[model samples]
Structure formats: C-alpha cells, structure tokens
Target: MKNYWSRWMFVPALIFLFSSCGPSAHIEKDKSVDFSRYKTFAWVDKDGEGRKDRNNRNDITESNIRTAVNKQLQKAGFEETKRRPDILLSYDLLVERSTVQNNDPVYSQPFTRAFYSPYYRRYFFVNYPSQFIGYDRSERSIKEGTVTISMIDARSGKTVWQGWATDEVSSRNLTSKEIDAVVRSIFKKADLAKR
Candidate 1:
C-alpha cells in the first residue's frame, strides 16, 4: 500500500515539472505534402518591406533570427540558396500590449483592549480575533512578443509548414540569444527528421 501511494503521488509531480518548463510552440503542417523533397530554401521577403520592426533595430533583429534559423536548418541537411529553391521561408515578429491583474488577500490584526464593566465594577481586558477583510486588486500593463515562421512551396506558393512562439518580451526586438531559443523551440516541435 505504501509503494502504491508513493507511485501515484509521483505521477502528478512529474507532470507538473514538465508543464512548467516554459511557453510552448504551436506547429501546423500539410500531411499530404512530401517534406523530403524540400532540400533548398530562400527567404520570401528578400527586401524586408513586409517586416513589422522597420526601425533602427530592424536589421539587428532580422540578422539574429536568420542566423539562428539557418544554423538549425543546416544541421538538418537543408541548404539556403538564392536560385529556384524547393521552399521559401519567411518569418515575422509582432509585439502587443497586454494587461495582468493580481489580487492579494487582506487581513485584520488581532489586538487586546481594556474596557470598564459596570456589573463587575472593574477594568477588564478583551481580546479581538483576527479575521479576513477583503482583497487588494491591481493591474499592470505588459508587452508580449510572438515569432512566426512559415515554409512555402516555391513553385506552388502554398504554405507547407508553420510554427510560432509567444512570450513576454522585454523590448520590441529580441537579442541574438533570445532569437536562438525561439527558433530552437519552434524547430524542436517540427517533425522534419526524414527531410
């Protein structure tokens, strides 16, 4: 009985450990498409006109994303080519404003007070019990960023695979390391081992 209870308790703990890792990536792909035929890739937005972040940091963030994605794809035997490639790749980054609400419990402090009683004709001390009061509510604004990557067939112009990740961001642009992690998470969820 002891062993069975211990084993049962461990299952929930294991599930919680994995669930709290971090934000998860979402992926979509065409099941009927043959992924193995895709060997070379090129950027769909070659001129950067469709990018969201076209400010001073636009070039830096674009470089970070491209470097990370290229590294991952090359490791999987996919090459980047400027000629007529098998697939066209495109990525986008978007940051949006959000609000978070927090509520904390409010409590009353216990205390003792002295009072005069007419029946007892003496001073008496009474203790007051602590109790729940109410809740303190607050709201704060935050910025969240989402990165999306898409792979389309060059000849047919149909998207074959797509992945995206969303998380709280510190700035409008992501650093190189942050971009790498985002790209890595997206590719990790992709089932392109055979290709």
Candidate 2:
C-alpha cells in the first residue's frame, strides 16, 4: 500500500524542479538624456513617505539609501556634489509582503514511470514507499527593493533620464552586497547606452 503511493508523487516533483528556473526582474528605461556634461550630481531623500515606516511613519530608514546610491554612482565615475549638480539623484525602497506558490505538476511523473515497467512492477511495489501528497503551498515573505535616480536638468529641475531594476532578494534586511549587485546591473545599462 505504501509503495503504491510513491509512484503517484514522482511526476509532480519533476515538474516543480524544472518550472522554477529564472531570475525575477523588470526594468524600464528612458532615452532622452543629453549624456554629455551631466557628470556631476547632488541628491537628497525627497520622499518623506519613503523614509517613514508604513506602520508608524517613523520606523523607516533601516538603510541609508542615499549613501548606497552615492557608492554606485561614484563607482561609475560620477562626482559627488554639495551645490547644484548637473544631475539630482534620489532613491527609495519598497517592501512588499506576499506569498509565492509552489506548484510542480510533473514532479512525480518520472518516479511513477520508472515503477511502471513491465518487468519492474513487482520490484517497485515492494520497494517504494508512500507517494508525496499534493499540497500546493506558499512561501510568505517580504520583497525589499530600491528605485534609483531619475535624472533632472539642473537648470530647469526637469527629469530627463531614468533607469530602474528590481530583484527578489532575501527578506531578513537589505544587504549592501545585494543592493550593489542590482544597482551595478542598472548602471551597466547606462554605460552601454554611453557607447
């Protein structure tokens, strides 16, 4: 009886293993920048709501987003500033708590198929245990993400260039490494555009 069940679970397991196979990201681009003479920058946290916690409007600012932005920008050869800069930069983080469902319809197919051979029926019946029960579940967690600078004209304060990227990072807290990875990727796009 136990052996009969394992056969049923083989396909679903295989289906799940193959289905979850890529990165989670979506980026939007703006291509109206006068890329020349826009190397200097000055920025600040403009969104008060971004710095405030959703619950109390006071518990936000876990990581200094501005500093992280500076790190990435400087690494790209843009100079920092105090007064008016050719570009003004600002950034904000967005955390969303949600559930991700796990589903693998073909996960159990292979195991079941192996057991069904003409000469192996009895062998499978004797050795295999209960099948994996189909219980589609969800992982509940948070998605913390960042939105970087939307370049503005220093003379007119009008946004001209912008790039964005997001990754589903682990939810303990935002790490500098994680932020750097995503930001660096977006900066690469800017560099590519320069060429």
TM-score winner: 1
Where model 1 places Cα greater than 4 Å from the true spot, the runs are 1-20, 48-57, 103-137
Question: Each model's TM-score, in the order given?
Answer: 0.68, 0.58
lDDT by residue (9-118, candidate 1, tens digit) is 98999999965665578999999998999999998766645457343357678788888888888888899999999999988788788988889999899999999999
lDDT of residue 162 for candidate 2? 68
Worst 10-residue lDDT window for candidate 1 reads: 48-57
lDDT of each: 0.84, 0.60
Give the count of colliding residue pairs in each prediction: 0, 18
lDDT of 2 by residue, 66-174 (tens): 5566776777778888877888865545545655667754233322323456675553433444566676655656574654546667888777766676667676355
lDDT of 2 at 129: 44
